[model samples]
Target: MAGMPSAHSSGDSRAPGTERDGGTWVVIPLFNESSVIAGVIEGLLEVVEHVVCVDDGSTDGSAEIAEAAGARVVRHPYNLGQGAALQTGIGYAREQPGAEFIVTFDADGQHRVVDALAMVALAREEDAAIVFGSRFLDDRTRPGLLKKAVLKTAVWVTNLTTGLTLTDAHNGLRVIRIDAARAVNLKQDRMAHATEIVLQLGRTGLPYREFPVEVLYTEYSRAKGQSLLNSINILVDLVIN
Candidate 1:
């Protein structure tokens, strides 16, 4: 698909072409998450319509899976970083025919559709431009000590840089209204773009909220997710940038 697009409406890519009455669009930045991408797409479809997966040059036939499972697939020619994929997805999504809001979701099944819907509803009720899913807002998410420490450190750095006070900086579940989304221009082509997203969105001076969302740290999610080295890389990104 050349165009079109979240409530954490994003997922890792792989699905079929599914359609629905459009209001919100979910953008999933996909890589090699072949096994779980279809499930994520289907789950999101139950709540909202118009799921689009940006396949970040995955080698495991992820784009095909996503298209087959009911999601429009945007394929990268080669392996690009998640930031680039997200930028592309959001950019593409915001241009869709009936788009009103965008959700950035993860493809590994760590994010919940209920949390995404709640965040979207919050945005509508509060007239907020941005709604961020924060695992640290309550006791629902229990990240390991080391992971929490590192993520908390990253939050501090993100707040310092973006001047936006937030409890969780890297939680992938986020709701961005169309105007706020149009203002986003992600330069960080890596996961570091998560912070870049905060910085750019904060500059918009639009209303934002943080809603508590659970992050399921399943064994599979953990294995496919950030490693110690990846965490440190994220930290260094904040420090150096």
Candidate 2:
């Protein structure tokens, strides 16, 4: 709804049947989200034709659930960090027959399907190489105070390092065109890859836009919120790599 020039009802269960239907593939880096993985994939399938879940050694049967939910499942032998899982998913998605765009979505159910669809539409309409979903673009997403502070810190670090002023850098909802997706080479193997992704995509000199998105902070998401220690570790990872 943010970048959409025309009115859109995102609640429509029918796939928009647009250029994005088969051309857009969602890459979700999943690790031990068995309880919500099925619903996440199911919701994605309602909007897009391709959904790829990279199971990062999830022992909780997440891979099976995702496959059963109609997603193409790629398994990791062990618990690689989020960055590795993303690299796997993106690589897998890019190889698909008709993949024109690769969307990086969170497996925690915080990311909304409607937002992803809108971002994809925005990319096609503007001929953008990348469309980043930013919660800070609008007041729709309300993270907790501490969470907000932590995210702001991440944004600061990302902007400072990447030379691109993005409102939300750690947001896991991003629509990257195949050309831009090809530019992604994440090696941090953890949360620090978020910053690295922005830097790499920026180096491509491609057209990009930030779309407003609402991240639903349910109890489940809040329970797995980013802590100060984790933030510090991500910073350390960035510094080291």
Candidate 3:
């Protein structure tokens, strides 16, 4: 774990079960998502008490929009990829006063706001270090044929490499305990970081679970860069690295 600290080591100062509220913070990583980030932030604010948005060197005014929408904004000077953005956001969450749990959400309007409650509740109830949102658990939300094929391949490869049996391995909407996140380091900067996170979690033997999540594949998200090819690139990155 290059980016994450050791789990058994006690680097984080927050004591377990010390916080009274057990508050959760939502972290959204955005890159040139000026059109949709505002709405995502507003929707998340309705449910979560704290929201942090990491602007990954977006040329567009994403940081301004996120700040105006009431999310604490962190900006990367250059495009460091989603993994770096997520790490930055998690670091911010760790610095917050009462951040017991952290949730990663997409700014491209794919994840639903209501799902956060279930993720948080499940983490608390099960004491799971990581709770991933699975779209394939329910067949109704399966993506297109090509996309589905890519996801299935990803699931297989992830299982082979990481030994974690996940129904939806590449889902962005995930809730994780702050301590667990701080423990598992993520070094990959590109899209492959998603797989890297899961792999690291498995290696550390962290407890995890998955729950059904709604997936809304809008034309905007599809057009903005989340294509089936990105999955291939992610795999390539994993292999090459």
Candidate 4:
């Protein structure tokens, strides 16, 4: 919080028309994540004032669960992928009157809630436009050998293409300044949009930082989607697009 203005305590009193400060809204893009969205929203509510959940055409009850958990819900007509879902949620966040920062989180239960708060603090203290969660910062939490090889190749290619040195390029947890986010025009609609985001950030020369984050590989995440083959698909998308 070095560069940011001091935040008022949650119980501090202020004028009726004064703006409230501290943590900003969190945007979680989910697709058929009924089993975990509630917990994600609840965990975030403890630290943030607003939580927006974008339901990317999930036939399941993910939207209902998010709404029930006290999150603002936005529903897409079809499954538009994580990038589009995030874009939709970001649009909603920009419209909020007092939202100063935007934090993008995953709905698959991969990102930890505590790390998200840490990312926010880093964003404020460092005055970064974007703050990403880097799982590779700690060697103990690294992925399997094959997975690591694929990600390393992907990171190398991303660096070559975007000219940005990033240790982990696929992490979903990120915090961004509202102004910097407003300047970005994310057009990718599928999984490849993850890489697209970084490329855009690099092209724009936005200030960004990477922070250590924990990874949770769960049975439900494995069952839901995101196979090893998806890496190939992402590369194909990157090449063709």
Q: Give the alpha-carbon lDDT of every model.
A: 0.87, 0.86, 0.80, 0.79
Question: Per-residue alpha-carbon lDDT of model 2 for 15-122, expressed as tens digits?
Answer: 545433667889999999999998998888876777888999999899998888878888999998999999999998776665788999999999999999999989
Per residue, candidate 4 scores C-alpha lDDT tens digits across 144-166 of: 78878877877888778888888
Per TM-score, the best of the predicted structures is: 2
List TM-score per model, in order: 0.90, 0.91, 0.87, 0.87
Over 124-179, each residue of candidate 3 has an lDDT whose tens digit, in order, gives 89989889899998875858888888888888898899998998878899998877
Q: lDDT rank, highest first?
A: 1, 2, 3, 4
Colliding pairs, model 4? none
Estimate the Cα RMSD of every predicted model relative to the unseen true structure.
5.0, 5.8, 7.0, 5.0
User: Model 2 lDDT vs. the true structure?
Assistant: 0.86
Alpha-carbon error at 187 in model 2, in Å? 0.4
Candidate 1: residue 166 lDDT (0-100) = 99
Please give, for residues 100-215, the per-residue lDDT of candidate 1 as tens digits: 78999999999999899899889989999999999999999999998899889889989999999999988889999999999999988888999999999999999999999999
lDDT agreement of model 3 with the native: 0.80
